[model samples]
Target: LNIAALLHDVGKIGVYDSSLRKTTRLSNEEILQLKEHPTIGAGIIKRIDFFHDIAPIVRSHHERFDGHGYPDGLANDAIPIESRIICVADAYDAITSKRTYNKPLSPLKAVEEIERNSGTQFDPEVVSALRNALEPNDLPTVQLNEDDFEEFEIPNECDPDYL
Candidate 1:
């Protein structure tokens, strides 16, 4: 379980876009590309010595509790418990993390969103776990003041590339 979850997003390294990687809404092509991350992650784990049992779990973490998820839609008990655990953890992390697309949600808001999506995009059990796991540190703490971006105007003679 640990091994699989740890490597779950490894495939993302190949086609990752730092600018939009954690956005709430992505273009269709970006969504398609993002879906491949799980497969790529599974493949990386499958080649390991003791990870044979973890491959399927890694591959199916993206699946939803209602069988509407990608790759394989093995719902409820059909999905491994370890995978389910990882699912909740992954969701919590994503919800609480700051991204280019959307600011990180407060713990209360994140829980509400997770609970709202229970049984559709996520497992009810996973939702329960998330409700229990939220902590003060789960929220992002980066403070960006307008002064942080303050800079002198560039000279017209300055080369943009060099600047």
Candidate 2:
């Protein structure tokens, strides 16, 4: 599960830098390309035999509980627990992190957004886990003014020395 979570966005490496760094809404074509990251990420993981078990989790993490997600429209319990958990975690981070396009939301506001989307964009069970996890401080809390984008890279077969 940790492996899947860490590498879930590895496919974003294939995306154009301009696209990833864009400060505005994406165009239709750009959105389609961006949505392919999960599939690309899963494929990359599958090539490593040891990571085979995590491939599906990475692939399905974007699936919505309402069966309206991309790549596969899996609904409710059809999605794996690992994927569902990752989805909630990913959503929380995305909501609370400052990105090129938007300011970060307050933690409280982000939680409300998650609550509002329960059973539609996220699994309720997973959201519950998030709420519980937050209450116990399982997740790290950073000062609002802190810069969170520390640079890091995953070395792959073609770039073993990159990192």
Candidate 3:
């Protein structure tokens, strides 16, 4: 699950930097291109033996509980449990993090947004777990610096050049 969470957006490496870094609203073509990330990421993961099992979960992370999401239209149990968990976590992070397109939202506001989408954009069971988890102390916000990461080369199998 953790591996799936970390690599779920790995396909974005293949996306155009302009589309990802643009501050304005994405054009329809850019939106379509952005939606291809999951499929691209899954393809990359599937090439590596150790991560083969997670490729499906990675591909399905964008799937919605109501079967309206992209890449695949899987709904409910049709989607992997790990993918469903990642979907909720991914949405929460996107809502709370500052991006080129939007300002960061407060954790409370983020939770509210997720709650509003329960059973549609997110799984209700996962939503319930999130609510329960947040009922305790507030989660500490961590600010990540680019310097914190050590440079690493892409593995041969996962490298875009090889793919």
Candidate 4:
């Protein structure tokens, strides 16, 4: 699940740089284009036998608990638990991190937004777990941006050369 979580957004690599870096709202057409990332991610993973087990989880991570999300509309228990967990984490990260389109929300505000969307956009249980697991102090003060990439090390365990 951890590996899946890390790689879930890999498909974004296929998105055009203009779309990925857009600082304004995407057009409806662009939104449609952006929504293909999940499917594209799953396809990429499925092609690798080592990651087959996680492909479905990646594909469904964007699905909302209320069945209104893109690519597929799976709701509630129909969604993989890993995907559910990742969805909440992804949303929290997105909300709390500075993005091209918006300023980062305070951790408190991000948690509030997650709590507000608990039963609809996210799994209520997952939200509860998140609330239970993290205090405001546990969050990073700054989002890791491209400038920080040089300092971000892939742990030895994650480097195939080490294996």
| Model 4, span 1-163: residue lDDT tens | 9999999998887788888898888888888888999999999999999999999999999999999987899999999999999999999999987787887786778888999999999999999999878777785555455565565666689678878
Off by over 4 Å in 3: 136-163
Candidate 4 lDDT at 134 equals 79
The reply for model 2, stretches above 4 Å from the true place, is 136-143, 146-163
Q: RMSD for all candidates, in order, please.
A: 8.1, 4.8, 6.6, 4.6
- Give the TM-scores of the predictions, in the order they appear: 0.73, 0.83, 0.83, 0.83
Clash numbers, per candidate: 0, 0, 0, 0
Deviating ranges (above 4 Å) for candidate 4? 136-163
For candidate 3, the lDDT comes to: 0.91
lDDT of 4: 0.89
> For residues 77-111, what per-residue lDDT tens digits would candidate 1 score against the true structure?
89887777788778867876665766667666777
**Poorest lDDT segment (10 consecutive residues) of candidate 2:** 136-145
Please list the residue runs of candidate 1 whose C-alpha ends up more than 4 Å from where it truly belongs after superposition: 16-25, 133-163
lDDT digits (tens) for residues 1-163 of candidate 2: 8888899899887788889999888999999999998899989999999998898898899999999997899999989899999898898899898788878787767877898999999999889878876773444444466554476765686775764
Cα lDDT tens digits, model 3, 30-109, are 99999999999999999999999999999999999999997989999999999999999999999888788887776777
Q: Residue 63 in model 4: shift from native, Å?
A: 0.1
